[model samples]
Target: MTVELMATAEHAPHREEFAALYAQVQQFYAQQMRILDADADGGEARWAATFTEDAVVELPLLPAPLRARAGLTHYARAAAERRRRAGSRLHHWVGMLDVRPRPDGTLHTRCSALAHATPPGATSKILYVCVMEDVLVRAHGTWRTAHRRITRDDLA
Candidate 1:
């Protein structure tokens, strides 16, 4: 007889289930980083779609957390415009992800993220090194960020 195991935050995931979850989480981050890097292409709307409508984002540089999709979109637009004006490009790299399943069915994740900036005729320079903690919810068979907190190395 075969038995199936269910995974939860309090208990370990079955091998097959854990592998699938890991892949999904990695793919989500890959897509998110790509959208963020495409700042010049007006990708903010597409990027914002990856988050829940009522998602909250906290950044070390901002005094207040960005609440909802509207706030997130505004921030993305402003950052894109700033990069455009400065003739620079920004790239985001995320690694060392720790993903765990929450009891409520949300995925809790923490990752190290690095922001690199490249100016016209200049080499890329590290702008910020941050730790990103996120709560991801499965919606419509895909993952969406419900909440995120970014703490910069300099500030932390």
Candidate 2:
């Protein structure tokens, strides 16, 4: 079962309703980023669970789009290893979110995403600045990403 999101807060017919939905979406991103930043056992799986089973992830750095949870999990695991080898940890910070309710009941969202890498005995530095767009669907009482596209500033 999916809940249809209301319009954006600025022009919403019901301000309270939109505000609640906005808070839920914000919390979703917070939890998702927390899982992505963690380097504990089952962290990959936890991060993968933030997306839908058939989610698609597209990145300019990748040769091909990663399809489904399995592909996403593999990518997360590999990325974790690369971070480990570099002796750095990555933190994904997202802001300036613009979310609109789609006619088909999904939400179209875009945000500024910044990634910082912190190495042992070194201060964190910005590694990537990107624009992330997502097609979000509400299912099982929570929002899950159905599709994600990342456009890095350096690559753009």
Among the numbered candidates, top TM-score falls to 2
Residue 32 in candidate 2 has what lDDT?
A: 97
- Assess each prediction's global lDDT (C-alpha) against the native: 0.87, 0.88
- For model 1, the stretches where C-alpha displacement exceeds 4 angstroms are 1-10
Writing each residue's lDDT as its tens digit, candidate 1 over 95-126 gives 88778787799989999999999999999999
Worst lDDT run of 10 residues, candidate 1, spans: 1-10
Q: Per-prediction RMSD in angstroms?
A: 4.8, 4.5
Candidate 1 lands at a TM-score of 0.91
Q: What TM-score should be assigned to candidate 2?
A: 0.92
For every model shown, the clashing-pair count is 0, 0
Residue 64 lDDT in candidate 1: 93
Off by over 4 Å in 2: 1-7
Global CA lDDT of candidate 1, please?
Answer: 0.87
